[model samples]
Target: MGKAAERFVVEGLVEQTPAGPRLIGSRCRGCGTTYFPQKASCPNPACTDKAPVAALLPDQGTLYSYTVQRYQPPPLFRMDGWEPYLLGLVDMGDGLQVMGMLTGVKEQEVRIGMTLQLVTEPLYCDDDGTAVLTYKFTPAGTAL
Candidate 1:
């Protein structure tokens, strides 16, 4: 879990799973609304119980939607300069929608239903030279 922890958890920690690593989310045992990395407060109005039990989310999924960011995004990240990046909404089969960049997808090839796996990538930097790693997606395999 060396690299896995480095990517998933900044402290290089991991909550091991038989499937793989994942950021644990909370499930509303009362309303059935699932959240990623879990929510301390329940989004459901019907259930006031903020007791969000931690649950590991599914990692595999098909691309639900996608886009390309061709400009510099905002700060609070380790990114600057102009570059084209792929953005997408991934459906991990459990109704979970996750957003990330395509680390594994090179230019010239991106499509809907492109299978993907989650990966953490360098966001951007300020003047301090600290790298901000954020969760991003990559092509499940060679997209060629």
Candidate 2:
């Protein structure tokens, strides 16, 4: 019934997709401006003439770049202790890009231009003990 309550009800990785399983985003048909997670505003001032339109994010893309955070990102995360992890940005063929955790990795291994997949992670727990979540990209395929 409350914000916190509502968030908890819908918390966790939404394996299911309303519009579709593929990522969804918005592209300003006016100025070609793009937004991730979708938005209701045209970020481009030139395109501000009208409300930002809704669009589905492209599912297929190449790994533009990647890196491993040896240090914990901080309080916003909960994984027992700080674990050096991998993170990466996926360049959806649609010109829109997304950042996500780099799963399917081998210790001390990372490469750019690799394929990726979206995986959700728990952000933190609310006072009511509800766990917040976020999506991250992980490297695809089993590690050698």
Candidate 3:
């Protein structure tokens, strides 16, 4: 049988680059505000330009805050090996803060203001064996 194909959990949310995985977002040309998950228009009330262009967010950021998910997520969320995981809000500069699953570092070692890097890992496999991928943050300089 052929190897299982990999796919992102959500399309257009992240892109694989030569350097590494990068988040796909939108930036306002008028006020320079950035947003994740991409936006159709600028939501800033003070900015006049409503159009937003696609932007690749920084690959690294600092952990702004975090929490542990001790319980299983709702039915919509799926994981191959379910376990308690850490979730973090990372500050990616330009006033942009992104929330993503934290990996590599132990929950007890997690700390605010720790440097993190963007990475992709399989969350689960599909019925056909396709690997479902999701973005996650790891301690900067950690080998994947």
Candidate 4:
């Protein structure tokens, strides 16, 4: 059989874990602040700390805010099938708030403060037929 066609949408952002897929981030060693996409150095202007440690964020969070994008995005962003989708920011209960696409829930069905969990799905297939996986948030306990 041919090898499974799979790849991450963005490297070093999400990782497979024993529990499941988890978002990867960096934590500021000086002030205990964490950020997604893994900041190279502390963003805080007041803090002089330059060191950050790799941190894995919780898969679950609350829907803090959201917006629906109905139009096709600009260049470099692939859209195999253009359709409106929910884009939201989730409060990870720490000081970090992560932004990602929302899936598996209708726009009308979404509610503020809704419990959500992280999921990885194919964003698109490349020319070689490798699936590019990206992280998304979904209403907790809603079947895949």
What RMSD, rounded to one decimal, does every model reach?
4.4, 5.5, 1.8, 2.0
lDDT per model vs. reference: 0.65, 0.60, 0.94, 0.87
Query: What tens digits encode model 2's per-residue C-alpha lDDT throughout 61-114?
Result: 577877778887665456534577776778887577777666667545666777
Better of 3 and 4 by lDDT: 3
- Scanning candidate 3 in windows of ten residues, the lowest lDDT window is 1-10
Write model 3 residue lDDT over 1-144, tens digit each, in one string.
127699999899999988889999999988899999799999899999887999999999999999999999998999988999999999999999999999999988898999999999999999998999999999999936
Over 17-86, each residue of candidate 4 has an lDDT whose tens digit, in order, gives: 9677899999889888888878889888877776788899998999999999888799677756768899
Among the numbered candidates, top TM-score falls to 3
Candidate 1: Cα lDDT at 31: 75
How does candidate 3 fare on TM-score?
A: 0.96
- Candidate 3 collision pairs: none
Task: Evaluate model 2: give its TM-score.
Answer: 0.65
TM-score for each model: 0.71, 0.65, 0.96, 0.92
Kindly give the stretch of ten consecutive residues in candidate 4 with the minimal lDDT sum. 1-10
Displacement of residue 99 (Cα, Å) in model 2 is 1.8
lDDT of predicted model 1: 0.65
Cα TM-score of candidate 4: 0.92
Please list all clashing residue pairs in model 2, or write none if there are none.
23-57, 24-57, 25-57, 100-136, 100-137, 101-136, 101-137, 103-138
Off by over 4 Å in 3: 1-3
